[model samples]
Target chain A: MASRSPLLAALMRLPPPAPVLMAGSHLLTRLGRKMAGRHPGMIARLGPEAGKRLLLDATDLPALILLQAEPLSLRLFPRRAAAPPSDAQITGNLAAFLAMLHGESDGDALFFSGELSISGDTSAVLALRNALDDAEIDLAAEFAALFRAPETVVRRLAVVAGPRLGLSLTRMEALP
Target chain B: MMELVCPAGTPAALRTAVEAGAHAVYCGFADETNARNFPGLNFSRAEMAEGVAHAHARGAKVLVAINTFPRAGDADLWHRAIDDAAGAGADAVILADMGLLDYARRAQPQLRRHLSVQAAASNADAINFYAREFGVKRVVLPRVLTVAEIDEINREITVETEAFVFGGLCVMAEGRCSLSSWTTGLSPNMNGVCSPASHVSYETTPEGQDARLGGVLIHRTPAGGPAPYPTICKGAFTSPDGAGGRQTGHIFEDPVSLDATFLIPMLQKAGVRALKIEGRQRSRAYVAQVVRTFRAAVEAADRGAEMPVGALAKLTEGQASTTGSYAKIWR
Candidate 1:
């Protein structure tokens, strides 16, 4: 608890509702709703019917995802200080969640090894997990369609500058 | 002929096991009733039925393991599992707890009963008791016994015996130990999981990538090196010594896998009725390769031939393999 630097703590203490922050949140909410309606199967991979709201809390930075079934709502809450009520909650760090989502590591292995956890409404959570496993979901492929222009631009940039950038990032950290 | 009973964590693995010449395949439902209760493993009711049909068509049998202890108020779930197994046309149901066994005996005596190793029925007396009391037809002997002890048990009991010959080794008596329970509030007996991945963590630190179980450091390897899962028993720990110092090592058991293929002939001669392979949580490809290698090994052993060169070393991925308690020492 004491390890965090004073500067970082002071930054965290700043108020939440900045103009840029509100604009970013509004954009994200629209994106989430668009994705929900366009690709309902992605969220349904959790279950055909979400009997109760599921909260996916990325405990690292307090990002949250609320899932609802009736009208199919998927909302993202960033830097939430308080958790909302949920039927089931899956808790993990950003990297662990990404590893599971990207299939870089086996979800079951991660669950068994404690990298991820689900508490509350086990049956619903199991449904979600099984659906995800069966879905073979590739977020990268999904986003490639949504961000095709950006992806191509990034590719062009990478072709021109990948070596230099890669070299810099590769040795950014040094061993103590 | 000694039957080679293999594990199938998934339906595809079950089919692969049967195709690879497994005499019988054991699996569990995708729930807490079975030991391999991970996120994406085990069978559904429809899948279990499908698996049974697949195995039966191939002249192989399917055994369902509902081996975890029944919870205080949720015994009905365990009971329904036995009923479901019977409904799925399972050849037999592997069980552990005495209460659950009795429930199965009363509810579905028609279903054949094999005692799971989770019962820790290591001796003839305990094995005989389960046989006499609950009509257990076969006892999957615990890993703690030697071939001679197994032979003695076979001589004393009327039931058949199955011994695990390959895959992960249980450091402590599986169901009897609560090391994981103390650490994670979960154990094989109640939750049908051990050193559950839900409480496991792997983090890349300045030192290297380290594996921890329930927040306790298990093993730390250099960056980009292999980091083993910190199953509590296999984790390295330090203890106080008499000379005002600390002794740091794998205090319980080293991270070694059990590969008893070389003892096939000795085990057969010792009156073992079946050779079991562990790892129901493995892949179908892994299941196929191990099952094929062991199937050939079991056949060669039956014909009095020497053990073949191991092709399953790829499955272990460089971990040391041992014959475990089967290799008796003359101290």
Candidate 2:
């Protein structure tokens, strides 16, 4: 029930022109490649499912992301533009996507709660979710490890910023 | 006191459910030996052993589900599941197939046995037969029974009775429905999947979205409306109206999931020993939230306090719920 952080609000309101989207797409593609390198088991587990192009529509943001696991790529497009063809799609807010990526929230819970919606190939979407779950992709930790920053600093930043932004940024560990 | 039996689709969910105060958590192997054979779900053999250790360390029990019927020529897979569950130190094995029950009784006589709802034992005679023949210690009563009928069955049967208090409601008698098989060529009994996601697709239409199962148009929802999972039983069907025109609506049942939290007191009074929550195909978050909610409700029921109602509205399918056959509203 916390308000959206000013930084997130500003990002949401920012106009996503063609150049900006193209640049974001390039950056995401690089990030995706880096993650694929870090989590080889996740891609291997996906099998042929890694080839499917999954459209992730973040309703609270100004862009949509089309992701593919094999040969890792992530392309962003302006929200108002016509959607590209994809094998599956998941639609949700930015917070839901972030939380799911960080393992802080359950993907099935978000779907059941109507906070997220899925269309097209459900099996592929399920494969992606399972692959992600098995990988335990902690976004903050991954970024810190990738950039050689202090893990504690990154984790502490996520813990501090997550609630203020009404999002789950840190990975939720198993209950003791 | 009624024990809380929750579902755990994965090792993470098993730990979460146990931490959430579940007395016992039921799960299946990552195969068709049990029901809920969904993609990227269930536990591996090593994971099962670790999960059992985790639950036992936390003062909880793990019930391995070997409920699916064995294939005509492939009984070894089912037998291996039973053996693996016992090897993992599970507290009990829930069995539906008579052959599996016979095998478990003979092979691992020390392993406790529970009758699965998939067996659809709604009457005392069936319950007693399983107990007498298989030494089954408990029975997960089919969702078709009313509380009054449950009380009657409890009076006649010696084994403990477990009833589903939340999650999906099957209109057809469990273990008997062929609707999903007819549509998708898969069944909960054989393939361990109902309306298998591999056979499901969604198409955007001018009016809204059309959900199809096995290329059969099953449900259509308006734009911005909640679209329930494309289960054949809850699908919108067109039938004869008896007046020349056709009637288009849910012929078997609506898209409402079951929520009987308010009926805890009545069920407890009916001699129910355990309360089960469905959805092993769900995420750990779902498992945790539901387990916590039901744990509180069960404790409140034990104290003769009012049970919490409408706390899980958002979790129910179509954002709606019903008591299902528990109230016998259809009759």
Candidate 3:
């Protein structure tokens, strides 16, 4: 193989990656575990079958392995799994995922514009989307509640989260 | 000034719409009584009571949509829906099924009734019939009529007219189609569903990614592409050209959402009482954006000034929007 170009070498010679990405992923995994423990009904939305897997690849973040059984489970993975551990995989960035979950924008529109992609068991993915739309999941509210946020600050956190997450302030008010 | 009536699939969406300047917000309880009856959407009875109080506190009215037609053996469900809507303090209940409308007339005479767009009551005579029989105070006109047609109907009908000025459009006659049922054995009128999630499937093939509705091919997009949901009317198909050859394309409608924000003036001049936005199945963000934009537009219209519609281009279906029957090209 030819030696790397000087420009390519320069591009590769960037600063070391941040320690926060790994730390954030660990924190989120813990939160996911807690949420899973509390909301078994949400996992049932996947399907009736046991051992159904959903691989969620949030582009800028760590991939998540979700097992959709009677008790749904989630874990963050450092790299792509060697085996296909999912019937379906939904790939999107945080904004796209937030838009999808919050109904902040049209999922079809997002998918059409290539902001989101679904591979494998389309029906299962559709079921998940419909389920999410039917229900409300406010991250800021859950966070606020978990932290025992002051009532005044909870509303403030929700208002700040609305535009950033493409959610309505009204909807965010109900989060806590 | 014309009122802005918006759809709220959930209580959060309802509150968001009201806060964002919706004069009225319509929602359904978490059941089959409403047309936008999708999973994880709509409200429970407690949620409804809270939502109504919230809207009323904001000086906004709440319209409960019991618009889905009552099934033969399930009349009691819709009957109870109307009763519950009234009990929950909804300003009015939007009804479609004639039998249910009649039920509301007799059972809750004090509660106001609006004929739902699901009734597809386009003509003055049809609208007048409902007004005379069920004492309907308003009619949520279908997306099929032009502004001129609406103006004519307004001149003849005694009840107020509500027109959908924004969001999704059904190309078929509202409340009268069986296309979804023919494919899925369920429909909005019968099962309170259309192109329901259970019947939709997608697959990746050598050709591309194909979406199917009830096992029939609807649309095919390239691999790793954006495949629009296989909503029947917005799906693509290949059919005979009448001359023997075949043609493949979107036969009914290109996947486009309706955006009549520019036509607010004409609709108001046509004597439309309320401007409705469709998307009860949307998020509170979407509701707030649309409501906020329309509120500005309606306020601008009151001042006889043109208001530019802002960044809603991203919220439309397929990134394309249409006026959809308002200008009457179909006529």
Candidate number with greatest lDDT: 2
- For model 3 chain B, the run of ten residues with the poorest summed lDDT: B221-230
User: Each model's C-alpha lDDT?
Assistant: 0.72, 0.86, 0.75
Better of 2 and 3 by TM-score: 2
Clashing pairs in 3: A134-B39, A134-B40, A134-B41, A135-B40
Writing each residue's lDDT as its tens digit, candidate 2 over B1-331 gives 7999999887767887998999999999988988888877787899899999999999999999999998887899999999999999999999999999999999999999999999999999999999999999999999988999999999999999999999988889988999889988888798899888899888767787788999999988776676677798888988899999999998888888999999999999999999999988777667778999999999999999999989877667877999998898635
Ranked candidates (DockQ, high to low): 2, 3, 1
lDDT of 3 by residue, A1-176 (tens): 12334663454343324464356455666655455445544544444433556677766544454545434445455444353467877777655776566556656567767677776665566556655554466555455555667645766766765565443443443544
**CAPRI tier of model 1:** incorrect
The numbered model that scores best in DockQ is 2
Q: Write one digit per residue (lDDT tens) for candidate 3, span B1-331.
A: 7899998876767877888999999998767888876656677788899999999998999999888987787698889888999999999999888899889989999999999888889999999999998899999998888888999999998899998877877888988878788888888776678887667766657876777778887888776554555788888899898999998888888878888888888888989989899888766667878889989999988888996664587777767788888886743
- Highest TM-score scorer: 2
lDDT of residue B169 for candidate 1: 83
| Error of model 2, residue A58, in angstroms | 1.3
Cα RMSDs, all models: 10.1, 2.7, 5.9
Q: Candidate 1, residue A137: CA error in Å?
A: 11
Q: What is the two-chain DockQ of model 3?
A: 0.31
Candidate 3 wrong stretches, greater than 4 Å: A1-29, A33-53, A67-72, A82-88, A99-108, A119-176, B205-208, B223-227, B240-246
